[model samples]
Target: MRILISGASVAGPVLAYWLTRHGFSVTVVERAPALRKTGGHAVDLFRPAMDISEKMDVLPRIEELATGANRMTVHPESARRPVRADLTKIFSAASDRHVEIMRDDLSEIYYDATLGDVEYVFGDSITAISPDGEVRFENAAPRRFDLVVGADGLHSNVRRLVFGEESRFSTFIGAYLGVLTLPNTAGLDRELLIHVGVGRTAGMYGAPHLGDARALFLFRSERELDYHYRDVRRQKEFLREAFAGMHADVDHWLDELDRTPAFYFDSITQLRMDTWSQGRVTLVGDAGYCPGPAVGGSTTLGVVGAYVLAGELARADGDHERAFPAYERAMAEHVRASRGVALSAAKTLIPTSRLGVSGLAQGARLVSALPAGLSRAFLRLTTKSARLYNSMTIDDYPPSPAASSGRVGLGVE
Candidate 1:
């Protein structure tokens, strides 16, 4: 089977890896000219995702690149001193196995794992898709494939072409987020500092592995802002306006926005689709069912989805007729569970008022002051949504006869 996957980020490369392992020819097309190396915040790989990574033989490398920050400091707008919490303890309590690695690092690890075996077409994009699996690309010749999958992020081009308008499937969570790289002037060493104001947050943390710092902004918006998703200048303006006069620290971060070459801005949104597959085309990860950006464990969900999608295909002998529905059935409940957590998580991260922000800061301080065991227990009890991380069970699929005999190899280049 010849499979074409759009977007070479986490889910695309992962799906490609499993498909090739199952004796299918896989080709990944990415819009970026090369592997994206920077400008993404840290992403968590909970137990299930770690298990999948181990199966892919990339866990050791992911561990090697895990973020070194062991603590998080919450700075309230009115407080003189910040409240610090131990990140290691918090995550350890959440899961027996947890790895927090930079998003770009994880992307590179997945890309490297598949680069030697799969065909990668960088600096191009799909313009259209036909009912019979014909694909048109902007910079390359049109081609036909047995199947097409969209692993692209929130605003997926493949989803737009195949599933129709994005607004139909997109759910705005009444907020916006922006992340950028900056200088480590905070002198942070394995620590993260977050400043919270009414309905807004500005954070600066060290990225020791990348030898720089990262600035993150999340602010509440009652309605979705009207702007081009791809326009960096307009996005920057929106961020500045939303966070204006909230804090001097935020102003400092915004001042450096124009100087930063790599910037990411997007609405805090979730993608909810009733069906992930239609005929020969389907969607995976954020393209199909993103709980919400940043707040939800989207990276973990994407990894699990890729594994299930490919495993189902292998189990069905590469029959989309059987595999697509099985994949949807396997992931439907998990997606629903994730969507339920998105709204509350967003509200917690970006509070709606000054009083809420203060209360959140006080709660953090109280949690930090509690005994270690007590704190962990308290966190586990309070964070009911964390269960979403391990909600889906992975079923192991035996390698097909062709795959077991090493029949799977690089397809026509």
Candidate 2:
């Protein structure tokens, strides 16, 4: 079977790799002229996602690029001084195996792994999909595939083309997030310095290999903010208003917003769909059932989802009729758990009250102050409530040589 996957970020390339490994021909379509260089925020890969990466023989490289953000200094609203925390210990207790890699780095690793074996069509996007499996592209000629999967991000073109408007399935969870890339003037090395204010939080961090440091901002909003997602100017204004007078450091970080090289802002929204599949086309990763962005463990979910979707397709011998439903059944519990986690994080991580801000500080102190054994125990206890990514298991699907049919774009485009 020949499969075409849209959005060659995390899930698209992952699915393409596994599908071809299972002997099915695969092609990936990306709208960008080339790979994305946004250097997105750091993303966590828990035990299960790490296991998937290991099986692909890319774990070492992934670890090579891991963001060594091992320490945190938080200045809470009510606190007179900064409270320091050991992020290394907190991470160790959170999962048996974990790696926090920059999002763009992880995407590049996955994309590079599938280079020669997979067909990649950059600078084009899917415009339409017919029930008979005919996919129309904006730049390339129309092509037919046995299956089509949407691995695009939250603002997915594939999802919109198939499902109705995103608002129908998207729920605003009363929060917003912004990130900017600027010079690492604070001289933070493997450290995250943050200010925790009522209903908002701001941080700046940098890695050794990074040429510029990144400033992160998160805040709670009772109602959706009035601004277009593509309006960068409005986003900067809103972020400024939210974090105005937060602290000298944060104010300094915000001051560089106008000159930053790359900027990203979006609502911490969740997608709740009755079903991710319709006929011959189905959705995967954020394009389908994104629990939420930053706080949602979405990167892990996307990797695991791609692995499962590919495994199911191969297991059913390219029979998507069987594979699609099984894939949904497999991911249902994980999705539900992650959604709950996102909702909780929206309030906890970005506190809405002074009391919540203090709790956030005390919780960090407790984590850093505890012994190794006790810390892991406490983390496990707290994680049982928010650590669905670690508990979820990825089913094994060894490659089937008999599963592949024909190849597409074998030589050149």
Judging by TM-score against the true structure, name the best candidate. Answer: 2
Candidate 1 lDDT over residue span 122-195, tens digit each: 99999998887788999899999878999998888988988899989898988888999887777887888888
Candidate 2 Cα errors over 4 Å, as ranges:
384-386, 404-413
Off by over 4 Å in 1: 405-413
- Let me know the TM-score candidate 2 reaches against the reference structure: 0.96
lDDT of 1: 0.85
Residue pairs that clash (backbone atoms under 3 angstroms), model 1: none
Instruction: Kindly state the number of residue pairs that clash in model 1.
Output: 0
Q: What's each prediction's clash count? A: 0, 1
**Candidate 2 lDDT, tens digit per residue, 1-413?**
67889998898988888888888788899999999998578888888889988999999999888888899999997578999999998888778788988889999999999989999999999999988888899988998887889999898898899998999999999889999999988788899998998899998889887877899999988899999878999999999999988888888999898898899999999999999999888999999889888888999899999999989987887777888999999999998888998888777789888898998888888988999789888877775433576578768998765654443222212
What lDDT does each candidate get? Answer: 0.85, 0.87
